[model samples]
Target: MSRRPGRVRRAASAALLSLLLVAGCDTGGAEDAGGGQPAASGAAEVPGEIVLASGRDVTGRGGIRQQLITEWNRQQEAKGVAYRARLVELPGSADQQRSQLLGALQSGSAEYDVVNLDVTWVPEFAAAGLVQPLPDRLVDEDVIKSVAETARWGGKLYAAPFNSDVGLLFYRRDYLTSAGVTRPDLGKDAGWPVVQQLIGVLDAARNRLPAAYAKGWTSQLDASYEGLTVNGVEAFASAADGFSLTDKEGRYAGSVAELQAGLDELRNRTQAAYTLPDAVHSDEADTLTDFAAGRTAFLRHWPYAYRTLHQSLSAEQLGVAPLPGKAVLGGQNLAVARGSQRTAAALQLVAFLTGKESERCLLDAGFAATRVSAYEDGALTCTTAKPAGQAAASPTGERTDRMPRDGNGRPAYARGTLLPALENAVQRPRTPLYGAFSQTFAGQLARLQGGTPPSDAQLAADLDRQLKRALPSH
Candidate 1:
């Protein structure tokens, strides 16, 4: 393991970080507070205004969360409940939100009651005691099994899934049809191999697709950022526990060779013109926006893009499928602030936010649900297609997953696509030093994506060295 500096490349990413790496990582928007004093939790019940802080304000009209909070507030007001809940909006950048929350929590401030955290930050917050672990009653199996799993670390439930996300391949059905190409089933097959085949097919058919579709495929491949790290994990490292990049006991389970191989494959694919030329500079929004503008036949992004693109594309034109690789999981989770005086009330709000009805409402608002029932009752998924060379299928059967629809009642994107994608989301490395690892990994990946990427062995060796720096020794 060998190469580079210790300066951490921090940025204010957050729900923009699903806004991608907020698939949706870009530069972060806020500052970091790493040296805040540890705060103690208030076990007693002090009721009053409980503040729920999140990176994004998914409240208000069309915000399923807002509706639930409104109802809760009404009940509280009517009953004169000691504590009533309200929302405290934060910066849109996921990373910035993290910085602010860290600053407050480390400073021993009780400014917040319920903390809506990014799934990736659970470990850091939990270790710092910035948030308290949840009772088993809060995070149950009823939440989407995989999503709920993100809330736990060392077998403790530190957060509750509020809304969850996974990456998917968004392709144009019309373009594929024009090319006489049958869309590939990305889910049924594993991530990287499926992507390889998809790229090959798209490359071969690029000439046949419409001129409006300027690119064969597009993704958040910009180097020097978290987006590339996500792509790398999605490709070669999603096998066991996603981007954890290590085994349950916290040892490197993925090899530099494996990651390098995938990077080389991507380099070849992009060089072959299957990926957009601008991809090296693109992030999630750039990729989605280009695809939505009909510039590309396919895109890889978080499901968060569906609502943003709904106005531009029809359901029929947009085809959703599993990503060739599993998606890096994105979304927010609920935790009670450690220093809050309204512990009991905050816990209640956390339950309500992560509860069944709330899940359904969130799903309908275009946020991916963290509960299986939300997808089932809300109709968010369809059975995926059989693997490549197998029979194509539809979201048929007597299933009851709720369909994601727009205000106009049109399907937001499609089923099977997002649902399967969410199920296959890979978690990132769960260390508190995620920013350091991400920064290092991103730099090496950027170097590889360059015209003269280092030899595989050299690149792999460099990666190993950097990760050893960012990660604790086994």
Candidate 2:
């Protein structure tokens, strides 16, 4: 707490950050509306078209999602069920899509049967009764345990996880080799200290650094949105023994001391010496762009970046491992709209989309799978065929799907790296007022990016005060 100790701590932190700056960088990707009929309670719902609404698929147009829907429709036709599912990709960013869904459901303007809700939005939508409670079987033992927790609010299942995500550490093996690193594969046990040491070696070999390499690492740290809050939570969770900003009831439960610890960890991680200068303002897209450009050696990004980054960098150049420290959990969940008349058929569609096969399909296409089988079970292959014209034949006459996969058809790192990361990932605060919580959390943390940032104790006190205002306190 003394000025001399503070200066020494700052110097030591800078030295540690210096180690990472020389070593790494960070990287890395909606839906539809309407078409439902109203039915009175106890009356047989019509076997009509089921409209599945969601944000744009990051896998490109006619992606795996559409392929699965096409497959479902084929099955329905063969069975003469008369219930076909159509995907309605909602226009706009996640925030805009959330607003659209809320307005549409509240006004009954869009009769969407199934809605894709972000993991964080599940609580809000369920709390407002916009989405109906789903059967427990919809989220069974096969689902990833951490992901399954996101489907419930108020002690009942309201949404089924369609896909799940967690942060992962991506590094350039070529860069490390160029810098003369002997063990370029930072393996499962690689922690922040290990990364810092690696960066120091990279710094020592500056003459051999990649041409575009300007920083050790980069991440989504934009304070205007959820990125900063996510990074903050990860650091907080890593630093605090059992960090939880809000309780199960969404009430403020964190303490000033905990906030101080988290703040300090975040500061150390993002010190200007080791982080990309622009990282303070970078979102996911920006960070991915920078990382892909070879601006940084290491990147902290979501699961999809594995496929996206692979498109530009070869397997020899790209390597991914579990992110050092904690990672925040992300992804969307599927829920039936409360006003849907085709509830039963819609539920069937939901089940099929979130089934073991469908989850495998999602995993193969780059999204994180919600089921353990998608990562671990070799027998569970993605049964859905690629839509016509979606896949092209390579020179070798084999189907060319760009995503790298193992013999089991899972993402190359699915079982060993991604699965454990998802299982251990921390959730963002779950609250009806999550919008307010995130905004406040991000806005307060932005101060840390300023030239004259507040001390950890000061920032912690301010954050603790603001969060208490944004969420209820016990």
Candidate 3:
């Protein structure tokens, strides 16, 4: 989760909880261990205590990971198991956490039993031999098949999915209807031209909607790693098949022409500005906040933004659809640490966290579940609509007064349509050097948006330079 600087303060209680969870697990709350040796070598039985190191702030409200850990601890303790959980919350940025984790692991000072890694880091972590392969007995074939495909390197499973997320198109139902445009049958394989046509229709009728709503579109355009990973690389991958930014074969499949065209459309066609002047430098939270505040008519964001947007706008006014253009797939995964002393316990923890009961808990806490079974649970199907007696009504009464209907006019968001879009969605390049590549890509995209035309030769040269810098020995 991303947050704007000074937009909101971290909740005190949640922050405290985050710290306590981490400190409780640390061997001695020792702040730093400078250049310590790697962990001792031994595959022993489960230890009495287990530590879970995470990159997210668990103290924040709506942190599903924090809630999952807390629930796991409670359930395990009740069953008379002697297991204890300690959480270590790192800074929120993926780069910062990655640097810290690499330092800790290389120095053999990191004491985490199970490490929560971003999906893209699997290849790098596995290549360095910093994480262990999952045991076969603990996870079923289907679960293994789903996660391993996303987190694999050289045909080995390095991580299991912890939480999953993806980009979906959020539109204004009332706006579309008032424009006299019944849902255009863009069909399942809708592309950029179709989306542009719809945006044009909305822009023409902007006067019909509330003044608060924006006349155009909004998405991640910041120059940060997320901007490149989500908007640039993902878009390129979706437009073409077998396109990977990084693979063992070491071939980069992105095209500068396609990337430039897409970025131009984002700027000129939608008239959408970056959250900040250097939006290519911003994070996903910026886009989410803009959409939630009614500043944009259409947005591409993960489902986690659903509750927040629902709280900000009425159902009649809010519309959730698959992204009009190509979108990238995004989600988190779970993995056992190579340095873990409690393999059995760690595997157990993974099983419990990804199980049916835990998925229900996560869904109830306002997070999307990865398990197919959780989607059908009755508890996950319910949503509270805006109170009818509220003084203000949604400009599209279809959205404001009653529970917003899904694309099919059902009582809830369309899960049937949403999940398939995410499952079949494209992903960023799976490279050990994805972080560096994203940085370089974001810079190029920024220049392109500034009216510089991009050429494949220029991008190929830049990528070559980045590859050398990121992987000198390779």
Highest-scoring model, lDDT = 2
Off by over 4 Å in 1: 1-44, 57-62, 182-211, 238-244, 249-254, 265-272, 378-415
Where in model 2 is the C-alpha error above 4 Å? 1-41, 386-402
Question: Which structure among the candidates has the greatest TM-score?
Answer: 2
Residue 95 alpha-carbon offset, candidate 3, angstroms: 1.7
Candidate 3 stretches greater than 4 Å from native: 1-42, 57-62, 137-141, 144-147, 178-180, 184-189, 248-281, 376-411, 451-474
Tens-digit lDDT track of model 3 for 400-431: 21334343223255356555665666666677
- Residue 360 lDDT in candidate 2: 75
Question: Candidate 1: RMSD over Cα atoms?
Answer: 10.3
What would the TM-score be for candidate 2 when compared with the true structure?
0.89
- lDDT against the true structure, per candidate, is 0.63, 0.81, 0.56
- TM-score, each model? 0.78, 0.89, 0.75
Ranking by TM-score: 2, 1, 3
lDDT of 2 by residue, 111-134 (tens): 799999999999999999999998
